[model samples]
Target: MLGDSAYKLALETKRTQAHLPMYNEALVHHLCRETRHIMGELETLLQSLETIRDEPDADTRSVAAQLAVKHATVKRNKRCLLAYQAQRLRFLQNVFWQVGGVPEEIKPQLSPAELDFFSGYALAVNTYKAPFIDLDLTVSDLPPKDLYIEVRVLQDCGEVQLENGSLLLSKNSQHHVKRTDVDHLVSRGLLQHIDG
Candidate 1:
């Protein structure tokens, strides 16, 4: 039993280490896809607005104005996504550093925003005399979740073996679980919280 437990720990550690790279890549890809989709929708709206703006009808003019607002909103959303992507990449970089550097091929190219984030992170850690640089600046101030909720899995998560039984998270699978139990998966876009 002891040997079995030891082997499980070792295997779980290995999976955790390997999962980071996959998670990081998945995050970047998701962000990029969302940004591109928003940009495409914005472009289409702009193109349609151009025609409406040239029309003499007042209704068309109002439509154009609405499209303009939508365009601006999409631009703002894209910027927010970009900012989030940078922050998330920086956080992953710190995590990689904490456990030793990631594999060269899997390492993402650092952006100026990421570099700036790291600079600020280092400064804050130094100023506070932090023992190790493993702080997750994102969502650090959020309140704890006390409610359990239902979530739908968007991807296969393999078999999560727990103390009593194992949970199978195949694609499109739904499960009722605590927020803390699926927080990481939701953050990684693998699971989605279903509002009741």
Candidate 2:
């Protein structure tokens, strides 16, 4: 079953068709088919790795080295396939993507502040393709702590506060953000370093 956020996103996507390439539906269809194939291949590679891991009779050391190399190769290929799919989505939908979802194959540039903001804010976001202008506008103020918790179930923790207000959670906390996500959020002026 879809989560509430996913269900809402599905509805919004149906209403707006922001991610579909209707102009070239045929092309997008083909791309989607190919993307599914690539994903299946990636899954197979992962399963192969698991098989090698479970092969008690096989040379575990050689299998470990092979699995690492296979994993990297799978990652690189999956990235390329994803980029292609994203480009195809852009072409089909003719809708603008968020600054962060511009397909890394296009450019990897993101400012430091945006990095911080995206990093911090990513912890609270659901889908990147949602109508973000409204929600994105609220980054400066941010959702209340409990509300953020409601929206993000799998997101990393961005801001944390201790039970006491003396020391910052960042000081004693191990919570961290990815550099890209940090750039994505901070550039938009969404994250503020606050005293806890």
RMSD vs true structure, all candidates: 19.7, 20.5
lDDT of 2: 0.40
Cα-based RMSD of candidate 2: 20.5
Candidate number with greatest TM-score: 1
TM-score of each: 0.33, 0.23
lDDT of 2 by residue, 91-162 (tens): 322212234333343223333433344445544344552656434432323334431221111333445443
The local distance difference test score of each candidate is 0.57, 0.40
Q: Give the Å shift of residue 10 in candidate 1.
A: 49
Per-residue alpha-carbon lDDT of model 1 for 158-184, expressed as tens digits? 987533467889999898876655666
Clashes of 2: 22
